[model samples]
Target chain A: MTGKLAWTKIALPLGVAALLLLAWDAAVRVSGSDIFPRPHEVLRGIIQLIEQGLLLKYVVASLFRVTWGFTLAVLIGVPFGLFLGWYGWAFQAFNPMIQMLRPISPIAWIPVAILWFKVTDKAPIFLIFLASVFPIAVSAIAAVQNMQPVYLRAARNFGLTQLQLFRRVILPATLPQIITGIRIALGVAWLVVVAAEMIAVNSGLGYLIIDARNAGKRYDLVVAGMVMIGLIGLVLDLLVRQLEKFDEVRWGYANR
Target chain B: MQANPTVQVRDLWMSFPGKRSGEQVHVLERINFEVRQGEFVCIVGPSGCGKSTLLNIIGGFLRGSRGDVMVEGQPVAGPDPRRIFVFQENGVFPWLTVTENIGFGLLKKSEPERAKIVAHYIEMVGLNGFERAYPRELSGGMKQRVEIARALAANPDIIYMDEPFGALDFITRLKMRADLVRIWQSEKKTILFVTHDIEEAVQLSDRVLVMSKRPATIQTIVSIDLPRPRDLDSAGYLETRDRIFSAMGMSLRIGENEKEALPISAQQPV
Candidate 1:
């Protein structure tokens, strides 16, 4: 029964996607446009990318940048969030700055990133890091502040030391929200990476799309590139969603 | 001097700053009490009468402005592991399963020791098949059981509970009271429980400390003097329950026996 359910979960979405692709192919054929690529043309364009080995290189380049930027955000943001959450004065002092920076889109920083890093890898990486850190840090702060006071009382009553309380109670109590924040940050980082690749650097799915359309009017390659990005993003989101199944953190995600 | 009580509070006063400027709202005033070793004592009062605030002071979670709370002959300064709190099913860690929560305080112990203690409490609470379940998977009564088990597994000498069964339904509350009595008989821990339920106090406690309305002080300490497996419908039970109600300024002699000379509203409080 479980196996069948799992099979259906995958098969149903794939079936719908195939139907959508067929409809797109039919629509393009009926329009009789020489410029518009059919589903088969898009497939051939992806095959061309594979034969040239650009697919692996571009996909890996994009993924590698996202991974490092997100990892750095987690490292810096979590501790900063814990500090801000735990201390009243720190939160009060730093909260205004966080709020101010949070609203500015990472895409808007492209020019500064290019100027500062001078068209190197650092430019796009910096943009991705900036896109992710605020959400990660702010959510962690809210998680700590929103914690039920009873948990702290119980932890204290059980004779946990200050450090132990942070490790045992505060971390676990705020973990579900922290995980949620990280997921949101990862999404923003992924989004910023594409835009960053469009101008700040080259050789990612985003650049593949723009370069295909501009250099040779290869709209087929552009559509293929978009499909790859969507598929990869879906897989990344699914992986993060799996974390919500943990027993300790499952309660927070029950309603969701 | 006199056999050192498990807990003792003298002239306890607690006041919080009111919403307005330069105004204070007194929660507990001139509160005084003592719980002997192995005693199961309940502080009963109307809602919002500072009974919980008094418990917090005695449990070392809060400080009384002008009084002393001594525990084991030492001035109560902060929360001690020896005095664990079982907060109305709210203290059980949600992220942890039953086994994990019960073993939480025993993190410093050996793995085998922690496992054994956790297993014992899980069985003691009658959660035989739910050893791996999380707090959200359990009922209100079951959640309270988990909280109690966690407290007991820590091997605390004293357990303070604040309205532990207030959120539970009538049937579950009755069952929990009985379960608590059974555990207390076997374990013999000093328990200081606060509640607004007169019957609950009379049924579960050896002595019920009834408190008056806001700026609350202990009005009477009525000894239950009832046998184990208490019958809630028994005449003695009704008498003791009525006694606590009377001390809280709600008498039973109003409509049936005597004329309603004093309106119940005049006697009882919000």
Candidate 2:
């Protein structure tokens, strides 16, 4: 019965997608214009890119930028967040700057990033890092702030030392929330990577879209790039969602 | 020299500075008590009467503004592992399974030793089949049991519990009280439990410390001489329960400051 339900769940979305594709095909054919690519044209464009080896290159480039930027963000953001959450004075001193910078868009950083990094690989990577870090840090801080007071008291009463307390209680207690923060930041990072690539870098999925349109108006390749981006983003989100299912972190998701 | 009480609070006074300048709110006032080794003591008071504050002071989680709390002749400088506290059911760590939660304090021990101790407490708490379950999977009663087991696994001679079963439903509370009594009898740990439930105090404690309103004082200490598995409907039980009620001014038409001893037989359903 569960298997049947799962199959239905898969079939339903596939059916909708197929219908959308059919409508797009009919619309393009009726217009009698080749400006807008049909569904099969987009598929053919993808196959052409694969044969040319550019699809894998562009995908690898985008993934590489995202992985580095997101990794650096996590490494810096978690500790910075824990520090701010642990120390009140530090939060008070720097919170205004963090809050001020958080609202600015990664796209807004494009001009500054290019000037700072001189159109190198570092510019888009910097933009992605900047875009993702604050959300990760803010979520980590919230995670620590939202901790139940009883856990700390219980930990201290159990004779945990300063180091032991953080390692045993604070770290484990905050991990589920931190993972959630990282997941959110990963989404933001992926978004920033594409936008950053559109202006700052010359080779990525985002670049592929602009290049396809501007180079020769290859609308089919442009549509193919969009499809790939959506599919990849969905897969990335699913992978992070798996982290929330871990036994130790499962409690956070239980009530929800 | 007489051995120091298993737990002692000497002229304890705890207050915190109020939000307004030069203002203070007295949480506990001139509280004094001692629990002999292997005794089960419960402190009972009306809601917001500072009973929990008094327990925190004795447990070394809070410092008294003007007094001393000594356990085994050593003054409480800070929270110590030798005196573990069991909080409300929420005290059990949600991140840990039953075995891990129980073995938390025992982590410094050897693996085999920690396993044995964790297994023992899990069995003692009647959570034998659920050792691998996290606290989210447990009912309120079961979570409290895990908290209690966690405290026991620490091997603390004195366990301070703050409203440990207050969140449980009526039937669960009753069962927990009985389970606690059985555990106490077998373990022989000195327990200091704070609660607002007089019936629970009467059923489980060796002595009940009745406290007054805010800036609370230990108004009276009522000892229960009844046998184990106390009959809740018996006249003796009802009388003791009503006496505590009357002492707390919850008896029919009794004022909050009423001090006059009342005849137990005169008690009616409040």
lDDT tens readout by residue for model 1, B1-270? 334588888888889989999999998888888889999999988889988888888788888888888888899988888989878647888988999999989989999999999999989999999988988999989999999999999999999999999999999998899999999999989999999988888889999898988989889889988998898789999888876666666657645533324676677666
Could you tell me which 10 consecutive residues in candidate 2 chain B have the lowest summed lDDT?
B251-260
Runs of candidate 1 with Cα error greater than 4 angstroms are A1-32, B1-3, B251-270
Cα lDDT of model 1 by residue, A1-256, tens digit: 9999999999999999999988998899899998989989989999999999999999999998899889999999999998999999999999999999989999899999999998878888899999999999999999999999999999988888899999889999999999999999988888888899999887898899899999989999999998899889888999999998888798887674
Per-model chain A TM: 0.93, 0.96
Q: How close is candidate 1 to the true structure, as a TM-score?
A: 0.92
Model 1 root mean square deviation, Cα atoms: 3.3
- Model 1 TM-score (B-chain only): 0.92
What's the CA error at residue B257 for candidate 1, in Å?
13
